[model samples]
Target: MTLLSSCTRAARISAAVIALLACGSVLLQIGLNLLGGEPLAEALWRMSRFFTILTNLIIAATFAVVAGGRSVAPRWLLAMTAAIAGVGIVYHALLSHLLVQVGAEIIANHGVHTVVPILSVIWFAMFAPVDGLRWRDTWTVVIWPVLYCVYILARGSVTGMYPYPFIDANTLSPVQMAINIAGLTLFFLALGLLLVGMLRLRGRKSAN
Candidate 1:
């Protein structure tokens, strides 16, 4: 088999393994939380609050990249996945340190935030279908992050809980929260464009 095909197989298998690990970590945390007397619904809701969890789900779906052999996965989906992974990495590096975790929480936190993101970027480097990406689809990448911000903000407004400090509407003024959100939105847009450019450039080099 060609090197490209081998990398494709490797990426698929790696993605599946990472996905299973992520799911297992999440389940372990949930089980632990319940055993500690946390209410079932609240435990689930808290799990969903982390961008880490959502990004890992996107990484899981990327196994679809390998489903049809040489056929490419949807470009928009790949873009969103890469963007979220980027965001997750940034969160883990800079923000997650503010919170404390122990035992299973530590394992679950790193599994989804660190391990999954590293594996995803490696998969993109080794096997992502760059040829299927288009510059025009750059705007599509922000959709998921935008929706997530909205959902979290609205939920936090009602529940008096915010996942991240920067976007905490309860503490920050509207203008400050908007500024933070806008900054993050811009970050997502720039990251998406960067990924598109990198992939397109790699595609050109591969063609030659």
Candidate 2:
């Protein structure tokens, strides 16, 4: 019970970090889009990567909390974050970022680019448990991530320019894109619900 009671404050801290990161990323991209000057695309891309990085940091901090015996994650949430980041980690680790390549070719050929891949690796480690590798814990950790994804997707359509390549509706076949977006949306929804559940659990623990 004491252990259960301890997780709430720390958990909220992790969550707040994620919220700020998401908001910051979106705002930065919006600003750069408006500016439309030299180095703007690179700036936008870098700012966008910070959102992903903060998310990864949040995940990392979540695991740190859980492993400290302060929190526990539901099995499904753990599996989902791991599964999603796994694919992303592999691709970014092995392949190249289009922004780095194309933006260089089209705009600034000699500029340095350091954003997506670095954050991808950082977020990939978000689920690591010091006690051991634990896949049963993603609920609390991934909540902000999922919610922000929805916020971004919905907002992106209105503003234009998605954070990443996968969800660009214009680039995909119509049927396929809807299916893709739907699936992604569910994952985000699940993440948000899981976080809410953990907070509820914390409440219950405190009430007792």
Candidate 3:
């Protein structure tokens, strides 16, 4: 096979592996939660509140599509990369020390927060298309995080549960919560713009 075609095939294989890792990790976590006596519905609901779970699921879906040889929008890929990157960064930087895990939980945690995020970003940098990315596309990356903040805050207002401590409404004041959300939003935007900038630079080098 030609080199380009061979690379494409290899990329598809890598995508499939990443997809399986993400899906399996998420499923394992859910199973563990159920085994730990969390009601199935409640476990699912609580898991959904976590940005790690949601972002991993998004990564799984996006890679699954690529593995199936389907095209993904460049902007969507950019958003996914940024979101997953944030998942890894925020986990390691802010949350890693707050929790203790063993066995399957350790596997699940690393899969979503470490392994998958690193692999996804590498995959994007190496294989994903970015031919038409724009500065405005960076804004799209924050949409998911913004909506998540709104949803979690709204639900926390009634349920008194939060997935992450930083934005926990019960402990944090209104202004503090807003500040946390804004900071996270800016972080996501910065990641997106950074990815776009790298891609632009790569394109320039290719043209030279």
Candidate 4:
């Protein structure tokens, strides 16, 4: 096969693997929640509160399409790469010490937060298309996270349950919660810019 064809095949295979890993990890987490006596509806709702779960679900869907030999918009793929990068970085830096897990929970946790993120970023860097990315596309990265912050805050006002400690309404003053959300939004923006920069650098190299 030509090198381009080889890369395309490799990208599709990688996408398939990532899709399976993400989907399986999410299903495993849900099953564990159900087995632990959480009602199915409640379990799913609780999972939706987490950025890790949502981002992984996005990864699963995006990559599944690529694996199916369909083209995804480059901007959407770029946004997803930024979001998942945030999930992994934030989890390791701020949230990793807060959790204790064993057995299947451990697998699910690492699969979504660590394994999927690492693989997704690698796939993007090595194989995913970057020819259409632009600096303005960085804005798209924060759209989902900003909406999620609004959602969790709105839902927490009624339910009094926040998914992450940083955003907990009961525990944090409004000012502090706002600061945390602002910081996270900035982080996502930074990640998005960094990816765009990488694309520009690659483009320059290819032009020479």
Candidate 5:
């Protein structure tokens, strides 16, 4: 097989394995934390408050793209996964102290936010299909995050608990929170374009 094809196959296998490991780490941590405290289902519901968990789910979905091939998964799903992974990495690096926990939590935290992001980026660079992606599609990347923001804010409104400090309307005014959300949306857009650019460059290089 050609070198690119070989690399693509390797990337696919690696993506699937990394995703599985990340999921396992997360589940193990949750099980450990809730061992004597709450039901597994309740613990999982609480854990879903963190965007890191959601991003891991996105990463897990990307595994389908890699394993099942381009025809099986849409390009938008790949773009969304990469966008969230980039956000997860940056957020964890900067705001880890706020979300810090002990023992199994540490493993789950880094597995999803740190390790998964890095490997997902590598997988996308090496294997994500880019032939049909366009700059115009970058806006679609903002849709998921926007909807998530709405959900969290609405949930926080009722529960009086925000997942992240930045999104905590109790501490920050609506205007301030809006600014933060706008900044994050812009960041996602930029990263989405970057991924698209990288994929296009690789596609061109492979074509040549």
Candidate 6:
């Protein structure tokens, strides 16, 4: 097989592994929740939840990149994934006090050590081609947010836990919730565009 095809296969394989890991982690979280019987149950639950969230976030990006990144170029994906990750870092690092409390504790209780995002970092390097970045790569990173938001909404309604306070449509008016969602989506989209632009430039250079 050609190098490109091999890389694509590897990426899809990684995504499959990641999806399994993420989904399994969810079951593990449920177990931990049930195990609240143990003294360290909360901590375990938190750790499981953290890992689950982190992996799902990163793996979703991987799927997005793997499925779409090839349409353009590898470098475009690499650059965009990096940018998307940066946006995530900024969002988590600089969240407002209200946003954090608004249900943030639920997600925070999960093991949020430096390791959570580590799983995702590899996707950008391993899956994204070293050659060129493209507009499509940006769209791949977005899969995480879009899918995750839906998961959170559904799970929250079932579990009585909103991952973040801002997302709690239960208390907030639908308008307020919509506003928050729209605002956050825009921010993520902007980040994706920037990443794509950066990758596209990199691709242009490699060809010369």
Span of 10 residues, lowest total lDDT, candidate 2? 106-115
lDDT of each: 0.70, 0.44, 0.87, 0.87, 0.71, 0.52
Model with the higher TM-score, candidate 2 or 5: 5
Residue lDDT tens for model 6, 1-208: 1224636566667655654554454455455556556556665545433323554445455454454434434543443444345434644565433343324334432322122334445565444444444465455555555565677777677777775666885788888988877776666677667555654555567689
What is the C-alpha lDDT profile of model 1 across 1-208, one tens digit per residue?
A: 2223534556657756766775676677788899999999989888788666676666555554453343434465456556656656677667876879888878877777777667666666656666666788777777777888998988887889887888888789999988988888888778777777877888789899
Clash count, candidate 1: 0
- Error (Å) of candidate 2 at residue 139 is 11
Give the range where candidate 1 is weakest over 10 consecutive residues by summed lDDT. 64-73
The lDDT ranking, best first, is 4, 3, 5, 1, 6, 2
Deviation from truth (RMSD, Å), model 5: 3.6
Candidate 4 positional error at 125, Å = 0.6
What TM-score does prediction 5 earn?
0.85
Error of 5 at 177 (Å): 1.3
Model 5 clashing residue pairs (backbone): none
What ranges in model 1 sit over 4 Å off?
1-7, 64-72
Question: Considering lDDT, which of the candidate structures 1 and 2 is the better prediction for this target?
Answer: 1
- Write out the backbone clash pairs for model 4: none
What is the model-wide C-alpha lDDT for candidate 5? 0.71
Q: List the residue pairs that clash in candidate 1.
A: none
Model 2, span 139-190: residue lDDT tens: 4444554555576667677767665556665576767766766665555545
Cα deviation of 78, candidate 4, in Å = 1.0
Candidate 6, run of 10 with poorest lDDT: 108-117
The local lDDT score (0 to 100) that residue 40 gets in candidate 5 is 84
lDDT of 6 at 108: 38
